[model samples]
Every structure is written in structure tokens, then in C-alpha cells.
Target: MADWDDGYWWSADGLRLHYRDYPGEGLPILCIPGLTRNARDFADVADRLKGRHRLILIELRGRGESAYAKDPMSYVPLTYLQDVQLLIDELKLDRFIMFGTSLGGMITALLATSNAGRLAGALINDVGPVIDPAGMARIRSYVGKSISYPTWLHAARGIAETQTSNFPDFGLHDWLAMAKRLCRLTPAGRIVYDYDMAIAEPFRVPGGGEPGVDMWPVLNALKDIPTLLVRGGLSDLLKPDTAKRMLETLPQMEEVVIGRVGHTPTLSEPPCIAGIDRLLARIAAAG
Candidate 1:
């Protein structure tokens, strides 16, 4: 039995993109994964709510099965926003709820500004207007790093070693599952990260480390729509103070903090599940 149907879309510049379409009832729910992550990250979350809502999981350009941009600079968030818009238009999605993580959250912020009237609701996972420098450094250190493993077990151990601080409670089985999700087995018998190394170019550009974009205006656009901000309580990317400031600006936003998790929360977590339920309830009530 097929778990999901394969779908494709073309970027404005003509690059082919990919997404996983999980069919169900109610309004569609679009899930956009974090930087370097693929549609697979949301598999658990989608399975949990299956049959209640149609879910579309996107694989951004340069990641997953999507074509890599000819110009690496096109990997920026604005470019990503445009790509998502094109996907929306191609799918003829008049309205849909969005679930975003990390870079995906940034995309959601901008989409809210341009597509505010069309959004049923939004779930931003562990990202905000101001990204923490410490978190940035940590991410930069690993992205595009030289990585090769002889065995799945070795790959899983590497992931556990590097990410244990982020998910302190993850056991051996959890790390192994995450490894299988993140690292793909090549026909040559080597294990490697699934995304293109060129995808890291945007991060190495001059001034890339700085939060050059003014996200306040974009976030302010979220006003009037029901929004949910899910943060990993120990998250370094989205500081408590910044989330506080965000709430101050968008008082209508519902917030949840998943303890011990860092950078981002796996929506499978109890708190995240509860938060999503509340957000969807609000969305359903809006109709």
C-alpha cells in the first residue's frame, strides 16, 4: 500500500521541485521542513493526524528529491518564499494551514505577509524574528561538513554525538531512527547526508551570519490570523526573550514550550501535538 502519492512542481525559474501528498479529509495542511531537512521529518506528525486533514509535505529546492538551484544564491529565504508561492499556485491551493520548522518558519513569516488572507492558520516551530548567534554558529559548524560512514550504526552514532545536546532524552532507538531518516544509503554502500553540499553556500556568504532581514514587519503581518509558536524549551535558536517579544506583538498567537528539546521540537512530542490540536481547532472554527 502506498503511504503517500508523489507530486512535483516547477519553480518560477524552471527547476523541478518535489513534495509528498498525503490524502485525507478537511482542509489541507502543508508541512515545510527545516534547513537541510526533508519532508520525512513530518512523517510521524502526519501519521498521527492522518485521515482528519489532507497533508502536503514539501521538499525545498536543493533538498530531498528537488532539483538543486543552478545559482546557489537562490537558496535564500526570499527565493524559498517565492518557490512556496509557486507551489501554492500550481496546486491551486486557495487556502491551507501551514506548519513550518526553522528556515521554514521564516518562510511562513513572509508568506503570512503576502498570503495572510489565504492562510487558515500557521504553526512556527522553534524560529523567530531574531535567531541566536550561538545557534547559528552551531548550525554553521555542521552544515556541509565532510561526513561519510561505513555503516548505519556508525552514522547513527555520529548523529547522536553531535545532536545529543539538542535532544537529551533521545535513546539509542530514537537516534538510530533519526539517522535512517537523515542519512541515505548510497548504492556504493556509503551513508551520506541527503541534501546537496552546494546548499550551504548561502550561509558562507559575507554578512550571512548576521540577521540582515527585518522580520518584524513580516511577523506583524500575522496579525488577525490564529498562529501557533512551538518552541523547544531549551532551544538556542529561538530565545525565550524573543518569543516573549513575539507574543507581545502578536497577542493572538498561541505558544507552547517543549522541555529539554533544543533548536526545534519534533511534532511527535506531547506538547507539540497538543499545540497543533489547539491551532487546528482554531482553524476549523474559523471556517
Candidate 2:
């Protein structure tokens, strides 16, 4: 069994960013979780890939065990990019491959563009430059809201009901696992999600605001690097048309669509795992 260790890296803004390091012999692969998610999201995937790669899962500021920023505005993507850089520096890793899902993917895209030299390659799961507005709006609706449930079973049921669109195949145990990962028990005996919900407030405020700065320029910067993009076949956020366009723009990019999945494909699924194996093989061959 691979041992997982917890560590912290201090950010430029004085925040302590938490992370999990799964020990392995080969190259390092940094796993970045989705919006409102934490390092535990990759637990199963990390276990699967442990022998081949050292999996480093970061708990971005305001999420997981990481400290929340005093300034809620610091929760934006740019701040996250800086935090990633700080993490890399603390780890003393010269180069690393990235596995990013959703919001994490956006950060990967930003790094691939601004600091290509530091990246070995990138694997973006179910996210791209152009996001669906309806999806964004839906996310905004719950991003910052406080969640309260009478019991873990109730919370699991809530996730099953509300997230059915994204995870239709998840079973009871899966929901329980998700609940465990997302919430923690406090001294007062109340269960609360690990993330500071306030971090999501900025997105809720009505503002077409700067149109989310074009990321095509960043994607263009990843042209020479080996890249793999995984899209859920039923995803509403990264539509098939957009994925096709992404491939058109980056001819070297490889892609896979996991069937019966939506928004994001948790790599634990067999098909998704197979796709990842192929992707890592390609990266190894290229090296």
C-alpha cells in the first residue's frame, strides 16, 4: 500500500496551502481538483496510479484543510495560479505533469501558457476555454450557499438527487464516499463541508465582468507540449462542438470521451482509467 502524507506550503499572500503526497518512484503528477472540491476527490485515482507516478494533490486555498483567505476576493483564478507556483517552488520540483478537473483545468491552461517550461505535460478533464453559460449559472446558484443536512444519509441523498446530472451511475457507497470527502465533523458535532463557502461569493454577484479573459491564447501556448483532454460524453459545460474546436486548434492534442458521464469523468471508472493509461503511455513515449 502506498502511504499518503500531508504537508503545507506557504503562499505569497501568507496562506498555508494544504496538500497530500502519495509516494511513488517515478515522475510527479500534480492533481488539481474541481471547483468546491478538495484533494480527497482524487483518492481512488491516486491509489490506481501510485506505482507509476507520485501523485501530489493540492487543496487550493479556501478549500480542504487549507486556510481561507481573509480577503474573499483572493479566491479567483489568478490567485490560484500564483499559489500553484508557490507550491512548485516549495516542492523544489523542476517540472511536473498536471491533471486538472474543471476549475483546476482552467489553472492548468493558465500555467501552460504563462510558464510552459515548468510543465512536463497536461491532462485536462472536462473543461475548456469556452464554458456554457447555463452551466456556469447553475454552479453559481449553489457555490456559496451553506449546506445543512440532518444526517449523512440525508446529505448523500441530496447529492444523489442534485448531482444526478453529473453522476448518474453513482451508488449508495459512492454517495457516502463523496459525503465523507466533502464534509468534516467539528468539535460541536456539526458536519460541514471542508471548503469555506464564502470563497464562491464573487461568482454569484451579477457581472458579465471581463468575459473570463480569453484562454485561447493560453491554450495556444501548450502547442508543443504533450496534452490529453478528457471530456464526458454527456457534459453540458464542455460541449462536443467546443471539444472539437479545441482539437482543431491544438492539432497535437489527444482526447477521449467517457460515455454516460457528464461534466467530469471521475477517473476511477474503468473506461476513464483506460483512457488515462493510454494518455500516460503517450507521455512516457514522447519523453
Candidate 3:
């Protein structure tokens, strides 16, 4: 049996988009990936929640199986946010839990402020209102660059070399798994990044590189809801102080910081999984 059914929807601009549908009962968990990531990043989360909750792992435009945008500028966050809303409408979701990572997390924050009533719960992964300049520079350095590997082994090694410090505990096996998620095999037998290289075009615009939102209001919107905040202990994107301020903003918020990880933590970690479970439990209890 297939683990998930292939799902597709159309973006407002007429681009076809895709997602992984892991069916179950009760409130669904809408999983969103980072800027360069796709539905594959949520595989572990789906594996854990498959039979327990409906999981919709979205692949934003220009990533994975989704069609690339005709207008490169449409790759901005506002477009992504609009795409997600369209998906929500397409699915007719009355209320749902959000599992957003990095750029996805920003979308969650925006939704929290605009669609507060539709949110059952939220898990903001490895991001806050303020993004660390160091992390911003690091992301700008590599996003949208065209690089391909002749073999899977070479692809795994390339990912490991660049991400070793972020995930110190990841082994060759782990890296190979990640490489499979982040890359795709071309018909010519070369492996390359799964996203459109043109998605980086917006970053070249003045003040367009950063999310630029005053996120405090976005965060405050979650105050009345059951929100879970996750951070990587060694993360350069979301500093410890920012995480602390997030907690201060909503004292009742639940937090999980996975030690030794940087940038973001895969929800597969024990602590991260437990935090998600706790949020789900709270949502269930309230309903």
C-alpha cells in the first residue's frame, strides 16, 4: 500500500502545485517546508502521525513535483502565503493545525494574525520575529545556486560537508536520507537541487531579502491559541534571546529546544516529537 496519495492543486497564478496526503481522522496537520524544501521534509512527521491525524505535506511552487512559476518574482513570501491559503480553501479546511518550518514558520505567523479563528494549533520551527543577520547572510550565500552531482554518494557527501555543523549527530546514512529528500535524479542520471534556481531572483531586490514583517504582532496573535515553539540550540537563524522573547510574549506557550542542532531541527528528534505530541494533545483536549 502506498504511504501517501499524491495530491495536486492550482496556484492563483495558474501554476500547478503538489502535496503528500497521508490520510487519517480528526483535525488535519498542514505541514509546510522551508524556502528551498518540499513535501519530503515532512516524511518523518507523516510516518509518526499517519494513522493518527490527517497530514497534508505541501510542496510550494518551484519545489519538488510542483510546477515552476512563470514569473520568478511570484516566488516571494506573499505569493507563498497566498498559495497556502488557496490550498486551505481547496481542501475546505474548517480548522487545522500548522506545522511550519523556517519560511513556512513565517507563513504560520502571518496566518495566525489573519486567520486566527481557523487555527487549531501551531508549531513554529526554528524561527522568530527577528532573523539573525548571520543566518540571513548564510542563506543568501547558497540559495538558487545551480549544482548537480553525478551520483547519489557524491550528493550525500556534498550535503554532509555543508550541513555537518548544523547536524553534528547525523551519520552517512542520515545524510543519504536527507540528500534523497533535498535532491532529485535527472533523466541523465545526475542529482540536483529540487527547487527552481530562479526562486532566488527576489532576493536581489533591495529590502526584499528579509521577511521584513514586524513579527511581534504576528506572534502576539498566537497568544490565545495553543502554540508550540521549537528552536535548535545552536541555531544561527533564531537566537536564544529571540526565543526567550517569544516565550515572554506568550508565557503560556510550550517550548522545545533541541541541543546541538543549528538552523532547524527535524521533527524526528525525540524532544521535538514530544513537543508536537503535547501540542496535539492540548488541541484534542480543547476540542
TM-score: which candidate is best?
3
Kindly indicate the candidate among 1 and 3 with the higher TM-score.
3
Q: lDDT at 260 for candidate 2?
A: 83
Candidates' lDDT values, in order?
A: 0.88, 0.83, 0.90
Clashing residue pairs in all predictions, respectively, total: 0, 0, 0
CA-only RMSD, every prediction? 1.3, 1.9, 1.1
lDDT (10s digit) by residue, model 2, range 1-287? 43698989998989988999998877799999988899988999898889779999999999989999998888888888889988887788877889999999989888776666778788899998888887787777777778777678887887778778888888999888888877777777666777998877678566531136788877897787778899998887898888998999887788888888887787777777877787778777877
Q: Provide the lowest-lDDT 10-residue window in model 1.
A: 204-213
Clashing pairs in 1: none
By TM-score rank, best first, the candidates go 3, 1, 2
For candidate 3, the TM-score is: 0.97
Off-target runs (Cα >4 Å) in candidate 2 are: 206-211
**Candidate 3 clash pair list:** none
lDDT of 1: 0.88
lDDT per residue for candidate 3 within 1-287, as digits (tens), equals 87999999998889999999999987999999998999999999999899899999999999999999999988887788889999998899999999999999998888777676889899999999999989988888889999999998999999998888899999989899999989999999999999999989988887665666788977888887788989999899999898899999986588899998997898889999888889999989878
